[model samples]
Target: MDIKKIAVIAGDVIGPEVVSEGVKVMKKAAEIDGRISFEFTYFPWGCEFYLEQGKMMDEDGVCPA
Candidate 1:
């Protein structure tokens, strides 16, 4: 079995809404594979955040705490 890390940036308005469905499908597909898994990390940095922080993502796209 193997684990995969997926970094998703559902940036701006409808981005999250659309990505959610895609993720849902991917999850189901992963389940059928049975030997692979997905680890999703959502980064809350987008246009709204950029308005406040002036950056779309971190220097490396990592979520800052």
Candidate 2:
């Protein structure tokens, strides 16, 4: 089995929408190919988050600390 890992950070504005569409397409591809799969990890850190948290993200935001 071949699996690919993807990290997604929906920053703001069209970022989420674009990522959503990409994920949908990738999922379809994976579904069609049994040997191929994807593992998606989402990180919530962006401009909108900064407005509320006063920072774009924590020091280890990417690593989820």
Candidate 3:
């Protein structure tokens, strides 16, 4: 059996909270089944981040390639 890693890209304020809840649910389900593993990465990018960087994530915040 192979375990798949999931990547969650949280974009803004509410994004983090929503993603957190989703992860919680996944954990519960995995605990019940006892056969799944997950990896989560949080990217901090939003209004506050834009204010600091002077650019949005879509622009130059992250390079495409």
Candidate 4:
């Protein structure tokens, strides 16, 4: 089996709802395949965050370095 890492940012308003459904679909696909798994990491970079912090995402924004 293979493992895949996913970064999820469920933004404000409808973004959260939409992201939830998309995650469900991905999980279903992985289950049916029986060969791949997903690990999701959630971030707080959304409209609300922007309103509060004046930035949509972090200064680094999940960068790998």
Best by TM-score: 4
Residue-level lDDT of model 3, residues 1-65, one tens digit each, is: 33656757666656877988998998788778878766675666778778998766656445554
The alpha-carbon lDDT assigned to residue 9 of candidate 4 equals: 86
**Could you tell me which residue pairs clash in candidate 4?**
none
Clashing pairs in 3: none
The estimated TM-scores of all candidates read: 0.79, 0.76, 0.60, 0.81
TM-score of model 2 vs. true structure: 0.76
Best of the candidates, lDDT: 4
- Sort the candidates on TM-score, descending order: 4, 1, 2, 3
Give per-residue CA lDDT, model 4, range 1-65, as digits (tens): 99999999887665888999999999999999999999999998877898999988888895875
Tens-digit lDDT string for candidate 2 (1-65): 89998888876776889989999999999999889999998888888788889998877765632
Residues 1-65, candidate 1: write the lDDT tens digits.
79998978886666988989989998999999999899998888888888888977678775565
Distance from true location, Cα of 24 in model 2, Å: 0.5
* Pairs that collide, model 1: none
Q: Report how far residue 41 has shifted in candidate 4, in Å.
A: 0.6
Model 3 ranges off by over 4 Å:
58-65
